[model samples]
Target: MSSPETFDIVVAQLGDNWTLTPVVFENEDYQLPDTPAPFVSVEIYGDFFDQASIGAGERDDNLWREGGEIFLHVMTPNGTGSRQARQYAKQLVNLFRGQDIDGVRFLDASIGAGDPGRSFSNYYAMTATIGFERDE
Candidate 1:
């Protein structure tokens, strides 16, 4: 089974980049203020596996890929127009697309507005799903 630590590393790195908005992580406790505002929710999915081979014999040349995805939930106030959501989505794409971090290669992200699977029930949302892989 793949350990979530791989994705958590990405999460940790994002801490230094949260100046735009407050970031809420999955399974963490947070105290939302009385006023509703824009925020981002991060979710991670890690998939690490061992490939079975015939007669490779643990060769150093043998390569395996460990892949994962990070989901960015850009949540904004419902009363506001979609502009704020789109702006956040753009920044998220710019941050993750074609980037290499700690050996993880992040690919072009797929984005969608008003995602049906929003992390926050009360906010209008745009979701950015980034697929990343690392050579192991």
Candidate 2:
């Protein structure tokens, strides 16, 4: 027997409409820690919106079952960016069309704030749910 590959599952579950892009922002706001790390941005193209809407709409009381949206995942210390973030974001687009994640709130008060906190490493070994805003 063979072990299931999550990456392949991600591709199969998410389909072709979803894309993962790697970005390195030098600016203070977008900069990661000193480590040479990679963060992923998962985007659902325009065409997939229609498909996501139908499936998510018919589901039970699920946040992703109401409206369409684009989610952003950030890497942190504990829950750093894993393959799941990329794969799941795409799966969300493929499985939950027209679903809304307007109220998805992620708290990070422990990360500190202001300049001191800014100097701290943002790119830890964990992936975090950064945002889930509506596409509109």
Candidate 3:
């Protein structure tokens, strides 16, 4: 499967939290809604697959590992200084860091402070990046 598909699976694993309501796992080619506030978006920005070595002069065809980073954008209403967004981003980092989804392992995760300029002028936004890998 593609990286975006993997992101869907990750969001499914996160389920939902009431503290950050209206969470959205955007599908491929999806556009952000104009009215939603205090929402979360999970998106995969990159993916990579590499062959695994089993022994000398031997590579495992079935051991190709899929890995990538998923970007999480948390947005809140304007003038909040992204306070809520930062909180939600922290929660996301705590939930996914060093965790595993099925057999997919999350190697690392981190979140940033809110940046109003990075998103809509009416919203405060914070971002998180999660790196994951799995044998496929």
Candidate 4:
């Protein structure tokens, strides 16, 4: 029903493969843990909706089709190459590809290296985009 709920569903789908918890909401302030390597986070970045039909009334009731884009951010240990980060991103993609969560169908996923300007030195950062939709 909400972004946090959707993020929890996604994390559950990731299962035992992922252990670290990163920030889930965009623009939410967060502090990173001082632990070791392999930090990960999931967030709902965007959403879209379409009205398919309108009911006949003074105030029309609308049937809506909704969808959203989920982003998974992964950071491996320092000195790890982008390959490792990409591998982790691939795993995240595989987990959600063609799967449905609470009636939300995951359509596809794309992975890529994180922005160099935003990433830290020696840290392998990658991001994955998951496309999902649902009829309501």
Q: Which candidate achieves the best lDDT against the true structure?
A: 1
Give the TM-scores of the predictions, in the order they appear. 0.80, 0.21, 0.75, 0.70
Over the stretch 24-44, how does candidate 3's per-residue lDDT look in tens digits? 665645445677557777777
Counting only residues 3 or more apart in sequence or on different chains, how many pairs clash (N, Cα, C under 3 Å) in candidate 4? 0
TM-score rank order:
1, 3, 4, 2
Worst 10 residues of 4 by lDDT: 113-122
Where does candidate 2 stray beyond 4 Å?
23-38, 41-73, 76-120, 124-136
What ranking of all candidate models by lDDT puts the best one first? Answer: 1, 3, 4, 2
- What would you estimate as the lDDT of candidate 2? 0.31
Q: lDDT tens string, model 4, 28-74?
A: 66665565466566677435567767774633366666678877777
Q: In model 3, what lDDT does residue 76 have? A: 77
lDDT (CA) per prediction: 0.74, 0.31, 0.69, 0.66
Residues 31-79 of candidate 1 have per-residue lDDT tens digits of: 7667778888888776664543436666645676777778888888777
- Candidate 1, residue 24: the lDDT equals 84
Scored by Cα lDDT, where does model 4 land?
A: 0.66
Q: List the residue pairs that clash in candidate 3.
A: none
lDDT of 2 by residue, 18-116 (tens): 344343222224544475444543332112212233345445422331122223343333345445444543443444333322332212221111212
Candidate 3 residue-wise lDDT at 84: 71
